[model samples]
Target: MELFAVEIRTPQWQPMILWYTSALNMKAAVRSVEDGYALLAGRGWRLSLLELQEDEPRDRSAISLALEVENLSAVRERIESLLMEPSAPIETSDEGFLQWTTTDPDGNRIKLFQFVAVD
Candidate 1:
């Protein structure tokens, strides 16, 4: 079975929405500001964002998402343009993928990668 969606709960509702849309280029498929929820679609996966109360217990650091991209550099530039620093610089994996690791507004890890072209 294929994975469809991942849900993230955060107190930074609008900031998280802006981060996913601008940084990852994900489209806001469903938005319910009144309900404090939003669904972001990227490629074939969907990300669900839900608002959380300040005193709510949330392990934002426990969530991670990896996205396969066609142009790692372009995505990097977009992320940088938004003044968001990556967790680390882009590097190539022994598995033959160029990967960039970064965190969302709420500190969720996001990995962006592209298959390395071998000549």
Candidate 2:
């Protein structure tokens, strides 16, 4: 089955929403402050953030959300504008992908990758 959306439960709901929208350039499609939820949509993916009462985060390291992007430079610029530093792009030519990674405000890993032809 095709994936519909990725959901993140976080205590830092508002900051997470802001970070995803501003840093990753995801569009805020639905926001319900009263309901403590937000939905962000990108090229062909949707990200949802739900408010949680827990102060400590779970082991989210087991899973990371990877995004396929067109312009790595433009995405990098947008990430930098949010004052959040992303890892340097690592080219895996053998694997036909160029990738970089960053974490959300709640420390969820976000990987951005672009396909590249092996020379």
Candidate 3:
């Protein structure tokens, strides 16, 4: 089965929205400030952002999302330009992928990778 969307709850909705839009270079397909939600689309992924309630528990360090990208380096550069530091150095796996991890403003982990065929 194919994946459709991922729901991310955060207290910082505006910055989260801005971050996703800028990093992915895509606009929200759906958004409702009143409802406190937004849906953002990239090449083959959809991110749903939900406003965190005051009573809800937030453990941003525990959230992690893996994304397959076309150009890992470019994505890394874009992220750095946005002033977000990657958590680790980019590395290639024996399985033929270049990867790196980074965190959002609220400390949500984002792992990005690109497949690279090894000769």
Tell me the TM-score of model 1: 0.48
Better of 1 and 2 by TM-score: 1
Alpha-carbon lDDT of model 3: 0.79
lDDT of 3 by residue, 55-112 (tens): 8787666555667788888888878876544347899898798988788887776778
Better of 1 and 2 by lDDT: 1
lDDT of each: 0.80, 0.75, 0.79
Residue pairs with clashing backbones, model 3: none
Task: Rate residue 13 of model 1 by lDDT.
Answer: 90
Best by lDDT: 1
Q: Which stretches of candidate 1 lie over 4 Å from their true place?
A: 59-61, 64-119
Q: Could you tell me how far off, in angstroms, the CA of residue 97 lies in candidate 2 after the best superposition? A: 37
**What is candidate 1's lDDT per residue for 29-77, written digit by digit as tens?**
9999998989899997899888988998866566666677888899888
| Reference-based lDDT, residue 15, model 2 | 89
lDDT of 1: 0.80
RMSD of each: 11.8, 12.0, 11.2
lDDT of 2 at 46: 93
